[model samples]
Target: MNLVTPPEHPFAQFVRILGKGKRGARNLSREEARDAMGMLLDGKVEESQLGAFLMLLRHKEESAEEMAGFTEAVRARLQTPAIAVDLDWPSYAGKKRHLPWFLLAAKALANSGVRILLHGGGAHTAGRLYSEQLLETLDIRLCRDWQQVEKALDQQQLAFIPLGDWMPPLQHMIDLRNILGLRSPIHSLARILNPLNARCGLQSIFHPGYQAVHREASQLLGDTAVVIKGEGGEIEINPDASSHLYGTANGVNWDEEWPALAAMRHVKPASLIPEHLLACWRGEASDAYGQLAIISTMALALRGLGEPRDTAINRAEALWASRHQVART
Candidate 1:
């Protein structure tokens, strides 16, 4: 019997580099990570190799530079419309405890004529409601492609591009959640992807530690971004708890604290009917918690777009108050 050994794969090399014994294993350099991620996104890596690379990276906890590299590959491959987008909003984390209050915030921003490109994917884990699943109930534009994103922006000024529709390979990595039994590095990288090279970005994470990670990577990527530990981990503020906000604008870095909006702690709604999101938007429902969360989230987006704190907060409140009463078209 004659058996030729299979050629060593570049991805396998990458896996070995990261998975080498404790002392031997080290994080990949920016360039190395960029190459690895580029290969993964292009479907050049074998499935088994892909799984190993993702798990290894996740276990090591990616560095800011590594995150920057992975995000670089993702941003390059995105199909963006020609339209000018003022904001980049990524909403990967699904709503586990609250309805998506940030969707209303995006809507209010759009009503005020701020063109936003909101992108995300979620519900890879059970018992969660992602933006894609609930945004439709409000009739918010859920674009299937860059063309639809363009049209939605032209018509509505706010649009969402679900990860699966915009970047299937990345979504495939995310979809591996069930098999992997843990989140992969793609979650953080996907949230940092400013696909259209927008002027500003808004990000939220469940962990407080990633604030610096996201801010540094955004700085390296040469854009302004605001990050916080949002409610239910979905870029929506927690009215019941103060938020630690971190970001950078221009050449300056920022670390600030935003006080909670609701006076008292809130209990998760007994049941979440997606319709409540729309009702709140339409002025038919007025839960103080939902209202404050929406306004605070909008203010964060405005701050990312270069508004001063007081101005952003004030403008967000005004925008929320004056939003259209009619349902989304």
Candidate 2:
């Protein structure tokens, strides 16, 4: 007796399109990628197909078109409000070696009237200190939805939203790190989401070659963004070493080198202390490395927002110096 072949699952086509033999496989077109991501976000894809699709894409590193397409699908479903956001800061990569000095930098900028939205996936990886956990200590509000986001941004010029709250599907994928034994493209896609369409998007990559990918992807998405190899992959500029900034603005792509803020490399702190961030901001602590990290990271964001190099650095320094006064007012 002969058996009839069953019809293929609709989502299986996407998995096949990506996982076909080396000779047959190819990157998906922007339209295909957008459709695939839409299905994933809508929970239409099955578990087996979902794993295969993501891992196949991961094996062959996602392209700018893929990233841009994925970002489009995500933004389409996002319920972003009309609130004007100056900076889109995604902090998915939790810090391990250093306290999240960038948080302090963001607080200073927010205090000085720069409306910023910081979103992150909860700490999926072990032994890292994520932004969401430390927000209370820093006195920044952790918002759960657009309503809270709008209120926080209006009240304090800053808001921190976790991925699980805004986009549960992406956060689910991030949490699958242990099961998959490798990170999916969701990590990179999350960084470029910029759900609020902020004028300036800040992205960081731990791996090399992704900077260019992020730059091209941001250009494709028509985003003014800066891509950096942040310290511990958290967008915090390391004071001990020179760093390169790859970015796009007004549809133009550019790169620049920033000198080390410290004369010599400083050893990593013995431990990451959460309270130190607030203490530094309150002018109760003096940490040369931490202070320089905050100013340099702020300057990078300011430059991404169209400030001149020297002027951005000067402005960041001034912002840090007067953070207490900004808070009081």
**80-165, model 1: which lDDT tens digit per residue?**
65778998888888886788898888888888888889888767888888887877687779888889988988888888888888
Which candidate's lDDT is highest?
2
Off by over 4 Å in 1: 1-5, 325-329
Cα-based lDDT at residue 83, candidate 2: 79
Alpha-carbon TM-score of each model against the true structure: 0.95, 0.97
Q: By how many angstroms RMSD does model 2 differ from the true structure?
A: 1.4
- Pairs of residues clashing in candidate 1: none
Alpha-carbon local distance difference test for all models = 0.85, 0.91
Candidate 2 segments whose C-alpha is farther than 4 A from its true place: 327-329
